[model samples]
Target: VRQAMVLTNNPDKLRALAAGGVEIAGRQALYGSLNDHNHRYLSAKAERAGHWLDEVLDTRSSRD
Candidate 1:
């Protein structure tokens, strides 16, 4: 059997943003901002990957 984490909960797909790696609004060049305008850019990728943006966003908010 696979081992699970003993300290915290895990999400469907765990990902690490890494230190100073988050770009939420042109604030950083990595993602070039994550505001409304630049946010929709993920729709296509998410659709292709068959992922739910709502669920992802909800999860982020809850975690924060």
Candidate 2:
């Protein structure tokens, strides 16, 4: 797990702005097609960057 302080210090407004129009957008057209390298990259981001990628992956799995 990453540090709580780091997680808390994230630029929430910046993320929200950057995610505009895509926060809940399905990843079917992109993430669904990730090759090994891409998948590993996303996994690392989820682990270190505290991205919600694991939850996204889980949602995809549940729908499969």
Candidate 3:
């Protein structure tokens, strides 16, 4: 029999799902630019998200 799978990017949700016995197949790639900003404000969202991605994947190496 084939098992069901789930895909998610949120770390908290991923952890919760895992705790509930959901299998974590792997992490999906997320891409964004630190340079991408509006005239109102500069953002580091991409870098922050990258950190979270690394934490979830438990890898220190870069993705892609």
The best candidate by lDDT is: 2
lDDT of 3 by residue, 1-53 (tens): 12224454456766767787777777664533422242112222324542344
lDDT of 2 at 38: 69
Residue 55 in model 2: lDDT: 48
Better of 2 and 3 by lDDT: 2
Q: Candidate 2, which segments miss by more than 4 Å at Cα? A: 1-32, 59-64
Q: Per-residue alpha-carbon lDDT of model 2 for 1-64, expressed as tens digits?
A: 1111122222443365345532432222223444545667767766777655664456546666
Which whole-number lDDT from 0 to 100 does residue 7 have in model 2?
A: 26
Higher-ranked by lDDT: 1 or 2: 2
TM-score of 1: 0.27
**Candidate 3 accuracy as TM-score:** 0.39
lDDT of 3 at 30: 56
What order do you get sorting by lDDT, best first? 2, 3, 1
Error of 3 at 16 (Å): 1.2
Error of 3 at 51 (Å): 5.6
